[model samples]
Target chain A: MSDFTIAQRERENVQVLELKGYLDAHTAPKLEEAFQSLLNAQRYNIIINCRDLSYISSAGLGVFMAYIEDVRKNKGDIKLSNMSAKVYNVFDLLGFPLLYEITKDEQEAFNKFAGSAR
Target chain B: MKDDVELLSTFADQATVAIENSRLIKKSIERERLVQEMTLAQEMQRKLLPQGLPAVRGVDIDAISTPAFEVGGDYYDFVELSETTIGVIVGDVSGKGIPAAFYMSEVKGIFQSLSALYASPRDFMVRANAVLSASIDKHSFVSLLYGILDVRTGRFQIARAGHCPLLHVGRSDSAYLRPDGMGLGLAEDDFFSDTIEEHTLQLAPGDACVFYTDGVTEAHRNSDEFGYERLRAAAGLADGKSAARMKEDILRAVDAFIENESPHDDMTLVVVKWLGLTA
Candidate 1:
C-alpha cells in the first residue's frame, strides 16, 4: 500500500500545507481533515506545496474542490505550488488550471497573495 | 483410572465445540453487516440515476445502465434546457461501489444545478470542472460527455472530458467522434481550459449518436475486452433502429460477447436518434 502525509506551517498570514507520498483513495481523508482544520480555524489563505508529493487520483483533486468556495467566500484563497510534472499532469488532465492559481514555487505563490493584497 | 481419562476427553470435546460455535457466530455477524451495507449502497446508487427518459421533440433518446457490483459508478441524465433544446449527459466515476456511488451523486447534483445556467456545452463543462475540481475526492475522478441538442435544427453540440469517444451512425456507416478534453477534477488551471475543446454535428434523418462510459468498451471476457471496434460494429449493425432498440441490441451483443462470464465493471449506453422533421 502507498503512504501519504501532510505537514503544515504559517508564513506571512498564509497557511502552507506540504504533502508527501501518494494521494489516492486510501489517503485522501487525511488531506480532507487538514483542509477542514484550516477552515475551522478561519485560516483560508492556503498554499499547498506539492514538491514532495508522489501521486494523486481524482479523489485527491476533490479535496480542493470541497473547500475552495468557503475559503474564497471568507476572502482567502487556496493556491498550489511546487508540483512535479508527474503530479502536475494529473491536475492538468482534469482541467484544474482554469479554477486555480498554480505557480512554479512556494515563493511565487506567496508572492501572488502578497501582490494581490498590495 | 480409565473412567477418569474418559471423563477428561469428553470435557475437551465439549470445549472445542463451544469455540467453533462462537467463531461461526462472529463470521455470521460480520457477513450480515457487509450485506446490509451493500443493500444501502445499492439503494443510494439507484436513486442517483434518472428515473425515466424525458420526451424531446425531433429526437428519440434511450439509455440503460447495469452495475457489476451491488452499486456502480456509471451515471446518465437528461435536462430540458429549454422548450427547443435538451441537454444529455453520461459519465463514469473511477472505481466502483460505495465511494464511486458517492462521487456519482455529487456529479449528478453538479450537472442538475449548473446545466440550466450555461447554454454552451463548453461553458457548462468549464464551470462544472471548476466546481468538481474543488470538491471531488483526491483519489477519484469522473469522465463525462455532455451535449446539447437543438430539436428543431437537429444540431448537437458536445464537450468531452476523458470519456470514451462518441459513436456517430449515419444512413449507412458509423464512426467514432474524438473530441479533445480531460476528465473533471484532474487540473485546476489554464491547461485544462486550453485542452478542452468542443465539437458540433448536424444530425440528418436516420442519423444517430451514442454516448457511453469506458465500461462499455472495457467489458471483458477472460482476457479480451469488448473493445471500441466491437462497439462500433455493434452500432453499425444497429443502424436504422430506434434509440431504444439500438440500446437494447448493443447491450445484447455485449452480453453475448461476454457469454457466461460476469461483467467486471458497470456498463452504460445512451443513444440519440434523429428522426428529422418529417417524423
Candidate 2:
C-alpha cells in the first residue's frame, strides 16, 4: 500500500529531482523512467533531494546505479542531498557515503556544482 | 427443399471441422516451441552455476543452488585467486525465469573477469557496480556477497551488497554479520563506493559462516514464511557439523517447513567451516 513519486526541476543547469514516498520494487521503474528521460534530453548533472522519501529498497537503489556510468561518461555527475535520517540510513548502510556526494541541503549540492564548474 | 437443407448443413459442418483442426495444429506448434525454449534455458542455467567447491587446506566448503523453476537467477561460485587465497561469491538477481537466468550469466561473467583484477573486495565491488550499472536492465539488480578466504590463516575479508545477512556460528553462539554495502547496479561513483563497507573475520576451529540467497529465508508454508530466525537457528544447531552436513540440514529443514508447498524462489546456500591448522 506504499506510494512513491518523483518531481523534477532545473536549477543552474543541474537537474534536481525530488523523491517522495516509498521506493521499492513496484515503484522503482518510475524512477528509472525519470532518469531515462533526463538522459534522452541530454541532462546529465543530476541532484536527488530525498527529504521527503519515506523508504527505499535495493531494487530502487539499482536505478541510480543503472545510469551513473552513462551520466559520468558524459561528463556529468549525480549528487544527493537533504535525506531524512530514515532514508539516509538505507543509503548509509549500503555504503552510499563513499560513492556519492551527499550534502546537508539542496543549496550545498548546488554549490558543489558551482564549485566544480569553476 | 429438404435435400437443399441437408446439403447446406453438411457444408457448414465440414468448414467448422477444418477451422478447428487448423487452430489445434497452431496451438501444438506454439507449445512445442515453448518447451524447446525452456529446455535450452535450463541447460544454460546449469552451466552458469558453480560446478564444484574448491578443496582448501583447513577449510571445508560446500554449496548448493536449487531453482524453483526451469531457470533461476541464484548463483554461487569459487574463483581460485591464488594458491593461498580463493574468492567466493553468492548472489541473487531480482525476479525469475529465462530473463533472470540470462542476467545471472552476465553477472557471472563480470565476476569472473573482475575478481582477478581487484583483490580488495571493496574495490572489486566498486568496479563491478560500474560495469553492471551500465549493462543491467531496468528494474533488475543483483544482491551479492563477495569474500576472500585465506586457507592458511582462516581469515576472511567480506563485502556485501544488499544481500541477506552473513550468518556466523562461533564456538559460543551464532550471529548475523551485516556489513554496509549496496547491491550491484544500484548506484554509481561516490554513492556506491562510499556506501559499501568491508569486514574481516578470523575463523578458529569450530567456526562456520553461511552465505545464502533470500530464497532460503523467504520459503513459506501456507501463508507463513520460513524466515531468518529458523535459518539462524538451523545454522547454529549445525555448527559443529561438517560443511556438507550443515548444507543438508538447512535444506532438509526448509523442505520440512514447506511440506507440500513448492519453492517460490531459487534457493542457494554456501557453508564455510574452518578446521584450524591442526585439522
Candidate 2 docking quality: incorrect, acceptable, medium or high: acceptable
Cα TM-score per model: 0.69, 0.73
Which lDDT tens digits does candidate 2 get at residues A3-27? 8889999997999999998786668
Clash count per candidate: 27, 15
lDDT of 2 by residue, B144-185 (tens): 898898877889999998778789888778888898887776
Specify the CAPRI tier of model 1.
incorrect
Off by more than 4 A, model 2: A1-118, B237-239
Best by TM-score: 2
lDDT of 1 by residue, B88-172 (tens): 9998787556888888889999999999999888888888889887877654678899989988888999998877778988887
TM-score of chain B of each: 0.93, 0.95
